[model samples]
Target: MRSRRGVIEVNTAQIREVADGVPDVCIYELLYNENIEVIEDQCLSKRKCDSAILASDGTVGIFVKPDLPEEYRQFLLWHEYGHFKLHYDENMHFNFYLSRFSWKTEREANTFAALNLLKGEDIYDQNVIALLISKGVPERIAVKTYESLI
Candidate 1:
């Protein structure tokens, strides 16, 4: 919410600040939660699975897979945090994961993630998707990553 630049984007620094108070963030180094999981392809390619979510208490459980550069991980975590902060308030009755179908909540959560992470501002002119590409972020995550910022 509060950023030094005064522009609100979905950058990792802002994300960390946003999630400063929330608890139980599980960032696995290699393994995934199966249900809620993040993965990083450890071979020749530095590809990472990005993130996952689980329903926990009044909050949504978040998981960030390993293998991303610190900056990218920050984005992924914020995305999950977006799910927690935005989606949790309105749609508590529905369980997102078990539905076996994508819902509007997920899209809203992603939008929150993008707005925070991408924080459209002049300083960071390029969108998150472009930034990720410039930084060599894996293609698999480009879509969601793009959605989050742009």
Candidate 2:
């Protein structure tokens, strides 16, 4: 993923390697090292909470709604990045926004984000739900991901 320069593309294998290799990955830094930019502007993606953008100029970015709570914003960024890494170069439009619905792509993106965010955490712990929630994952998503891991 980091092999490219001045271009927008997706390679999930490379992305997984990077994510897995890092202990305590910082999503922002993860995207930055991959040449993806993060933009916070509510107007850019009014139709959804966040969006993955592949610009005409070859710049790749995730656009997030600015007024969200910090924790939600964090997860939204990862969700958009999931869209970026997993769907962008496959068969997706140049601009894609996420809605709180259960479409296949949206579900896949959410699953992708959940897996990465919850990786290496002890899902068996009693505090797992609270832990993931405190870490910015929504309760429903946290519980779903936790159940899947179990």
**Top candidate (lDDT):** 2
TM-score versus the correct structure, for each prediction: 0.45, 0.66
Model 2 TM: 0.66
lDDT of 2 by residue, 24-117 (tens): 6778778788788888776855564454455445678777766778877777777777666555564334333333222544555555666677
What C-alpha lDDT, on a 0 to 100 scale, does residue 54 get in candidate 1?
60
Instruction: Go through the candidates in order and give the C-alpha RMSD of each one to the true structure.
Output: 10.6, 6.6
Off by over 4 Å in 2: 1-24, 44-52, 55-57, 90-102
What candidate 1 gets wrong by more than 4 Å, as runs, is 1-50, 54-61, 89-93, 100-103, 123-128, 132-150
